[model samples]
Target: MSAAKPTIAVVDYGMGNLRSVTKALEHVADGRAHITLTAQPEVVRAADKVVFPGQGAMKDCMAGLLESGLKDAVLEAAANKPFFGVCVGAQLLLDHSEEGDTPALGLYAGQVKRFPDGLSDAAGARLKVPHMGWNEVWQTARHPLFAGVADGSRFYFVHSYYMAPADAALSLGYAEYPFAFSAVIGRDNVFATQFHPEKSAAAGLKLLENFIAWDGQR
Candidate 1:
């Protein structure tokens, strides 16, 4: 009899697409763990690892969490378990968001902001606001999440808003889109990314594996 496998929960708050995320986790799990998609706070609280994946407006995201009554559970998990946040889920960890002027979970001291319009690159070329498609993520700090992941790995992104942490130390990855932006942020048990790992291919899976193996330590 060996140690029991870990149970990972992909939190579902009826905000974004949860199926793709759940399927992705299942793919990477490979029978090494149990993957669950849950909106119940109790179920989430009991999971060994938590993956909070979200997209869409911050107001709706926060509303979904609250409406589902999983906000406290998520907060508890963030402070306790090995936690992972993706996209809007990552943004919710901040203090506030400009999207509908939403007040987020505030797991970290920061704000989620909308990218400025009419922005241009060095060549006076126009850049989109949503910043969709695949973009390169440059690691800014050394952490287990980037264990097998290269310093500059491309990940799928789809969002109009981005985060800017008050404490720069919380920023672990950066991506340039005409201007530099924090693509990843982590500290202690919490690790988050603005991009979608499930959609990201090999590098993303590797990062998830590292997260699963992480013990929530420094």
Candidate 2:
């Protein structure tokens, strides 16, 4: 008999484009796993793997997690299961965010800060805030989720703030807007990306594919 497929939870905290996240996972899973886009704590906690996805405002993200009562479940999964965080979902894992002065889940010790003013590129042109569009991510450390992905692969990004972990060892990848910033961060079973892997086309799909197969180590 074949083994049962894993149940992967795409945490729907009422902030992100859940359909896109879910579709991406479903595409990658290819029937090897069950993808659940849910706001229920029980569903999140019962899943074999968890994906925390976020967008919009930090205050709203936090509020949605509380309102949906999925915060504790997400924390539990991050601590013990294979968890992946994307965009604002990634930021919320930090200690705090300059966006709305919001306090985060504190699973990782760090702050999420906005891009400073007067930022200029190498040619000295002004760089835009939110850091929209595509940017190349320079992987800083080896992790199972990075399998089959090149070191400096470009990923889709749309955020004004970036995670700055207290421990530099937690940095998984770096990308530059004008200066290098944490593009990916992880430790243990938890992995996160400032970029939306769902929107990153081939490279991003590859990442999601890897996460589905990852054992949550390193």
Candidate 3:
């Protein structure tokens, strides 16, 4: 008998680029996974896994979640189901953000702040906001998210702010600007990536496949 397919809810918080994410997930899972793009809280709460994908300012994304009444549902989902966040969506899992002085979901104990001034040298060659385009993800620690994926894999990135989790042990991937910052994070069932895995090509697809196949017991 075939194994039961897991239902994944791609959260629609009015801030994410939903179509591309949905399309990429569909392709990787080969139609075996049920991907639902929804704003409904119950759908999120009921799903086997929840993906929080967004691209926008932190303030706007938080406000959208509250306005949609999905905040409570997300918290509940995180308590039980496997939760994944991408880009701005990943940053929201922290306690607060320096961006707009916004408070976050507080699922993880940490703060998100702007890249420090020292990140660049006197020449100012590396320090640029919204770090765009393809960059390499250096594996810092092994996690289920990195299963079937190797080190030095390049992923697409486009963001200014980055995450600094209090527990550095949760960090799975790091990227260099003038300094290194968290790229992929995995703590228990909560996983997030600062890069756009959906846009990262084959490596990205493999990461999604790993997430879908994740048993979530570890």
Candidate 4:
């Protein structure tokens, strides 16, 4: 008998860019996995894995989450199954965000803050806000999600704020700006990234493939 395909629930909290994420996951899985973009609490709870991808301000995202009554459902899913968060969705896993002074899901430690001087070289030229375009990510720790990925690979990035986890050990990847910041993070069954894996091309697709193959046991 064939093994059951994992159902990935891409949470739709009104703040996420779900279309691209859904398309990317579908492409990576080659139709082997079931992907759903939904705002229903029951749908999230029933999925084998959950993905929270967002693009927007911290305050607005949190507000949508609460108003939808999907916050508790998300926490429950993360506690019991494999969970992934991207960009602002990943930032929301922390205790709080300096953006709009909003409280987060507190699933992980530390806080989120904006890039002080924006991206800068050693000489200190302003690289601009939003931190748009592609950047290299240096893998810092071993995780199943990075199974076939190389140490230094370029991924698509577009964000202004970054996360500072209470425990550096939880960090899986780093990228340089004026200084290095956490690029990917994983702890137990939860995984997150500051970059957009959907937009990262082949390397990003590999990451998604690993997530789909994960059994959530380790």
lDDT values, one for every candidate: 0.89, 0.92, 0.86, 0.89
lDDT of 2 by residue, 1-218 (tens): 11368899999878997899999999999999899988789999899999999999999899989988898999999999899999999999999999999999999899999899889999989998879999999999999999999999999999999899999999999999888999999999999999999999999999999988887877
Give candidate 2's whole-model lDDT. Answer: 0.92
Give the runs in model 1 whose Cα sits over 4 Å from its true position: 1-3
TM-score list, all predictions: 0.96, 0.97, 0.93, 0.95
Q: What is residue 215's positional error in candidate 3, in angstroms?
A: 1.6
What digit string (tens of lDDT, one per residue) describes model 3 on residues 1-218? 12478889999989987888888888888877788999999888878888889899999999999999999988887777778889988998889999999999998888887876545745776566768889889998778878888798999999878899998887878988767889987777888999999999999999888878776656
Looking at model 1, residue 38 earns an lDDT score of 95
Clashes by residue pair, model 4: none
TM-score sort, best first = 2, 1, 4, 3
lDDT of 4 by residue, 55-129 (tens): 999999999999999999999987888898999989999999999999999988888988886467888787887
Clashing pairs in 1: none
C-alpha lDDT (0 to 100) for residue 37 of candidate 4: 94
Q: Rank the candidate models, highest lDDT first.
A: 2, 1, 4, 3
**lDDT score of residue 25 within candidate 4:** 89
